[model samples]
Target chain A: MKEKLYRAGDIFSRSVGLILFFILWEAAPRLGWVRSTYLAPPSRVFGALWLLALRGELARHALISLRRVMLGLLVSVAVGVVLGLFIGYFRRIDRILDLLFQAFRQMSAFALFPVFILLFGLGELSKTIIIFWASLWPVLLNTSSGVKNVDPVLIRSAKSMGASKAFIFINIIIPAAAPEIFTGIRLGGSYCVMAVVAAEMIGASSGLGYLVLYSEETFNVPEMYGGIVGLAILGIGLNWILHRAEKYFTSWKEV
Target chain B: MAKIQARGVNREFQIRNTLGRKERLKVLEGFDLDINEGEFLSLLGPSGCGKSTFLSILAGLDKYDGGDILVDGRQLQERSFSRGIVFQSYALLPWRTVIKNLEVGLEIRHIPKHERRRTARQYLELVGLAAFENQYPHQLSGGMKQRIAIARVLAYQPDLLLMDEPFAALDAQTRENLQIELLRIWETDKKTIVFVTHSIDEAILMSDRVAFMSARPGHIKEIIEIDLPRPRTEDIRNSAEFAKIRKNLWGMLQDEVLKVQSYGGYL
Candidate 1:
C-alpha cells in the first residue's frame, strides 16, 4: 500500500504550500481576479483589524468572546471528564447511556439553540450553554472510549505485578488514556470558541461574533473580514497552546 | 522439586449464539504439567494451542475452573509479585521511559524513589540498555523494546519469568542476538524462565525442556528434556546433536501443525 502523501500536524514548518496560499490571497483582490467588494483585500482587512484594535473595539469584543469560551470550556471539561470516566469505567452505565448520549451527540449541538434559549433564556447563560453543550460530548465520549479501549495486555501485566485496582486506575488507566483525553479536551476547546462565536453572532449584545455579524449587517466589509480574521487567530492561538499542553502532559507517548 | 504444578486444569470460553444460547469453547481440558525451579522451560506449540492460556493461568492473570495449580507448593489464587510476565508485544507503557518502566514493579512494591531508581539503573545496565534509560517505548526498535521488557521483568525480581514469545516480532538477526543476551542474563541470575514459542529452533536453543502442546481442547503432548550442554551458542545450531533435537521436535510438531492446517490452513 502507498503511504499517505502528507501527515497531519506536520505542516508547521518548511511550508511552501502555506506561503503560496498567502501570496495568492494577497494577489487575488489586487489583481482584480476577485472583486474587492465581495472579497476585501488582505491588507485592508488587516488594516481594519489594526484600526479596531487601536480604537479598543477589537480588544473589547475579543476579550468578551474569549471569556465566554474559557468559562464554557472549564465547565464542560470538569463535568464531561467526570461523567466520561464514570461511563467508561462502569460497563453497565456505559451500555445504558452510550446509545442515548450518542443520539444526542449525533444531532448538531448548534441546532439546539432554540431549546437552550427557551430553557436558559436569551442571555449569557444561553450563549455559554451553547458552547458547553458543543464541547461536552468530545471530552465525554473520548474519555469513555479511552478508558474502555486501554490495552488489556497492559492491564494484565500490571495485575500480574500485584497492582491494586485503584493503583492501576490511577497509574495505568489514566496515563494510557491521557493521549485520547487530551484529544477530547483540545477538540472541546475549539468547539467552545466556535459555539460561543456562533451564539454571539445570533443574539449577544457584544463579542467578536457579534462584531462580525454587526459589521456585515452595517455593510462594513473590511471590519467584517477583520472580525473573521480575529476568529481565525483566536482558533489558531487556542490550538497552539493546547499543542504545548499535549506536549508537556504526554511526554511519555510517541510524538 | 516441582516449582510450579497444574493438576487437571480446565478453562472454557462461553460464547453467545445468535439465538441467545451460550456455547462453551473448551480451550484447556484436564491439562497437567510440572515446572522445576531455576530451569529454562519452553512451552512450544502452534498458535491458539492454549500455551499462552496456560501461562496466564500459571501467572494468576486468568482463572481456571477444574484444577489446582501450585506455585512453590502453594495453591495459586491471585497474581503474586514473585511471578513476572513478558508479553510478545513488549507491553511497555508507551508513556514511560525505559528506566521508569523498569521501576514499575518496585513502584508497586512501594520501594522508595531513590531505591527504585538505583535498581532500575542496575537492570538497565544488565540489559546493556543504560544509555537508552530516558527513551520511551516508541523510541526503541522492537529488539530494544523487548530488551527493556526483559530488563523490567528482571528488575521485578521474579523467580519465575513467564515470557510469551518475547522475540517473535523481531527480525531473525535481532531474535538471535536477544536469545544470546537472554542466555547471558540467565547465566548470571539463573531465574526459572518459562518461555512460550511456536518456533522449534527458538525452543531448542533456549530451553532445558520443551513442553509441546496440541490445540482443540489443548493439553501437553509430551515433555522433552533437551540434553544439550550449557552456555549453548549459535555454533550449536550447526552441530549434529542440535539437528537431532530440532528434527525430533519438528517431526512431533509437524503432526500438530498438520492438524492446524486441516482445520485452519495458515501459520
Candidate 2:
C-alpha cells in the first residue's frame, strides 16, 4: 500500500501539467467552447491514434520517418566528426575554409530543398539529404569549437611531458572535445527530426508529416491532431534517449 | 656543469597595442641563470615580469627571439619528457579520474598498463591523495587538484620540473600545507626544480635559492642562496634567518612592484 502511494505520488508530480493539459483539451471541445472540427477533443484524437495503431499504419510511418532521420543523422555524424577533426586540428584548413563554411551556413537548408530534389532526384534521397543538410552545421560547429577550445594549458602541460601529437589527439583532444561534440549531436538530433518533418511534407507519400498533411486535407482533424501528437512524442523520446547517451558518455563531467 | 643554463636569453611577442596597431613587446631580455641538478630554485618577481614566460621558454613551450638555453649541454628545440611542468591552474584533464590523470604521461610514453597503474598509485601516495584515486579533478579542492598535478608530473619522472606559481590559487593554509608536502617530495625525487612565483615568502620557504627578477623585459637581478638548514618545517618560517631573507627579498621586489605600477597596475 505504501509502495503504491509512493508510485502514485511520483507519477502525479511528473505528469501534473500533462494531465491538466489533457483535461482542458477534453473539456474545451466537449463544452462547445472550441469547435471539435478545428481542434478535435482529447478522446477523439486518442481514438484516431488507436485506429492508426490498429491498422499498423502508425508503426510503418513512425519507422519510415525514424529511418530517414537515422540515415541522414548517421551521415551527418560521420561527416561532421571527420570534417570537424580536420578543421579543428589543421590550422591551415581552418584558416582557409572558415569563411567559406560561415558564408554557406547563412543559407537555410530548407531553402535548398528544390536544389536537393534536382540534384538527388526526389525520392528518399532528397529527403535524407535535406535532413542531413539541416543538421550538419550544429555538429560541425560544435565539434570544431570544442576541439579549438581545449585548454591550451592542458596541451602545453602534455607537451612538456613529451606527449606525442598522435598520443595527445587520441588521449586528450578527442576526450576533451567530447562534451561539446555530444551537445552538438543532441542539437543535431533535434534538427534532424524537425528537418524530416519539413522534407516529408514537401515531397513524401508516406511518413508522419505526410500523414498530418493528408489528415488535414481529408478534414480528419482528429487524425491530424494524432499526427502532431506523434511528432511531439517522437521528439521527446529522441531527446530522452540522446540525453541518456550524453550522460553515459560524459559521466566524468561535473555537470 | 649546470643542469640547465640560459645565457642572454631574449623573447619578444608581437601583440596588438591599445591603438590597435601591432607592436613588439619584449617580455624577456638578457636573462641568465644556471640551474643545478636536484636543487629547488624559485624565480621571484612582480606580475607580468616574464618569470612564467622564462619558465615556458626553458620548458620549450615558447620560442625565444634571441639568446641561448641549454639543457644538459643540448640546445632546446621542442618539448621533451625530460622536462615536466605543473601549471598554476593544475591543468588536470577533467574527463579522467585522479589515478588516470596521473597516467597521462605514462600512457603517452606507451608504458604497460600494470606498470602505469602502479606508478600512478605510487605518486598518488607521494602526494597523499591515494584515497581519492577514483574521483575526477572537479571533485577535488584547489590544493588537492594542484597535488594531483604534482603527482601527474612526478609520475612521468622528468629530470627538470618547471612550475608556474602552482600554489597561487590556493588559500594561505592550503598553500603552506602543499609547500611543505612539495619539499618532502622534492627531497625524495630530487629533480632540478625551476619554480616561478610572485610570493616572497613562498620563494624563501620552498627554494634552495631565490632568483629575484626585474620588471618586464625580465632578467634575474640577483640570486640569493638560502643557507637555512635542510628538512625545512613550519617552524622555519618563524626563524630569524627566514625573516632576514624575506626582508631582503621584499626590498628587491618592492622596486619591481613599483615599476609594474608605473606601467599600469600590479597583477
Candidate 3:
C-alpha cells in the first residue's frame, strides 16, 4: 500500500509541475510581463494549432518532415554500420581515415547548410543529404570504437576453438560491440532531426521547420508558438522511439 | 611419446616506455619442456614470469622469437587447429546461448549444420550444462560461463589443450571445483595438457609435473614431478607430498616474485 501511494504521489507531482509551467506562461502575458500582441498566450497557441489541424496544414507539414527523417536515418545507419565495421577491423584503414573524419565531424551542422543548399539546390534532395551528413559521424565513430575494443580474451578463446577469422567477427565481435553501436544510432537519430529542421528553416517549400519560420515572418505569433511546441513534441517522441530500440537490441548486455 | 614438445624457445616484445624509450623486452628465454601423452603439466610462475606468454606460443596464437614448438612432431603453423586454449576470462560470446557458443568451432570448420548442433549438444552435456543450453553467458554464473568455455573447447576435440590460468578469474571455491572437473576431463580425453597458473596450491593439485619459472627474461627454474596417485581428492592437498612439492616450488619462486614486485611495472 505504501508503494502504491509513493507511485501515485510521484505522478501527481509531475502533473503539478506541468500545470504550473503552463499557468506561469499563460499568466505572464495576462499580467503584462511582455506585450501579448508579440509573444501570444497558451490559449492563443492552442487555438492556432486547432485551426491548422482543421485545415490539414499541420498533417501535411509533419508528413513531409517525417518522410525526410526516415529516408535520411535509414541510409545513415546502413552506411555507418558497414564503414564502422571496416575501420574497426583493419588498423590500416583507421589510420588513413580517422584524421579526415575527425576534421569533418568538428565542423558544425548548420555551417554545412549553405554548402548543401548550393550542391543539391533548395529541394528535398538538399535537405536529405544534410541530415545524412550530420548524423553519420557520431554513429560511425562510436561503432568503430565499440568493435575495435572487444575483449581480446574472447577473441583468443574463439580462435582456439578452431574459429576462423570471419566466424569470430560475426559471432563474437559484432555481438560484444552491439550496446555501444546502439548508443551511436540513438545519437545519430537526434542529430538527423536537428539538421533537417535547420535546413527547412533556412529555405524550404514545406516541413514543420518551414511552418515555424513562415508563421514568425508573417507575424502569426500564436501559430509560431504552436509550431515550436509541435517541434518539441516531435523531438521528444523520436527520442522515446530510439530509447526503446536501444533497450530492445541490447537486452543481452549485463548493464 | 610426448604429445607436445618445445625446444630452446625465446619470446621478445618491442615496447615503448612512458618516456618513449623503445626497448626489446625478452619475456621467455631458452624455454624447453615436454608433456607426455595424457599428462597434465602446469607451467607455474609468478606474474610476468612468462607462463601466459609461453602458453600463447604453444597455442599458435603468438609466435616466438626463436626455436620451435611441436605437437606430435609438427611445427606450429598459422591456421592450425591442433591445439585448443582456454583463457583466464570466461570469453563466452554474450549474444549466443550456450549451445550456439559451443557450436562456434564446428561452424568455423564448415561442418554440416545438423552435425554442428549434435556435437555442441554432446559437449554441453559433458560440461553438465545441458539444462542451461538456451541461456546467454550473461544469465549464467562465472563458473557456469567457464563451463561453457570448456564445453566450446571440448567440442573442437583438439589433441593438445593449452589453458592460460583459466580459473584465475573465478572465486576460490569455483576454482577448486573446476580444477577437479578439469582433471576428470583430462582423464577421459587422455590429451596432452599444458596449464599455466600462478597458484602453488592449484599447481600441486592438478599437475603431474610443475615447471617453476623465473621473472622477465623468463626461463624454467625447476620442474618438480608429483608422484601422487590418480583420483586425487581434497585430501591429497593436505598430504606431506603436497607440502614438500609446494615448499620446493615456493623456494624456487621467492626471488623471482620479489624481483617482479620490486620493478613494479618497470619490466
Residues A1-255, candidate 2, lDDT per residue (tens digit)? 999999999999999999999999999999999987899997999999999999999999988888998899899999998899779988788899888888766778889999999999879999989989887888897899889999998888888888888878987889999999999889999999998988889878999999999999999999999999998888888888989999999999986
The most accurate candidate by DockQ is 2
| Model 3 TM-score relative to the real fold | 0.93
Expressed as tens digits, the lDDT of each residue in B178-213 for candidate 2 is 999999989876889999998988988998899989
Which stretches of candidate 1 lie above 4 Å from their native place? A1-44, A217-221, A252-255, B16-22, B260-267
Model 2 residue runs over 4 Å out of place are A1-11, B263-267
In candidate 2 chain B, where is summed lDDT lowest over 10 consecutive residues?
B258-267
Q: What TM-score does candidate 2 get on C-alpha atoms?
A: 0.96
Each model's TM-score? 0.89, 0.96, 0.93
> Which candidate, 1 or 2, has the higher lDDT?
2
Indicate whether candidate 1 or candidate 3 has the larger DockQ. 1
DockQ class, candidate 3 = medium
lDDT of 3 by residue, A1-255 (tens): 999999999999889978999999899999999899887889999999999999999989888887888788888889998999889899899999999999988988789888988888888888888889888898898889998899888888777666788888888888888888888888988898888789789778788899999998999999999888877777778889989988888777777
Better model by lDDT, 1 or 3? Answer: 1
Lowest lDDT 10-mer window, candidate 1 chain A? A1-10
Q: Please tell me which predicted candidate would have the highest lDDT against the true structure.
A: 2
* lDDT per residue (tens digit) for residues A151-192 in model 1: 989999899888989989999998898888999999999988
**What does the lDDT read for residue B158 in candidate 3?**
81
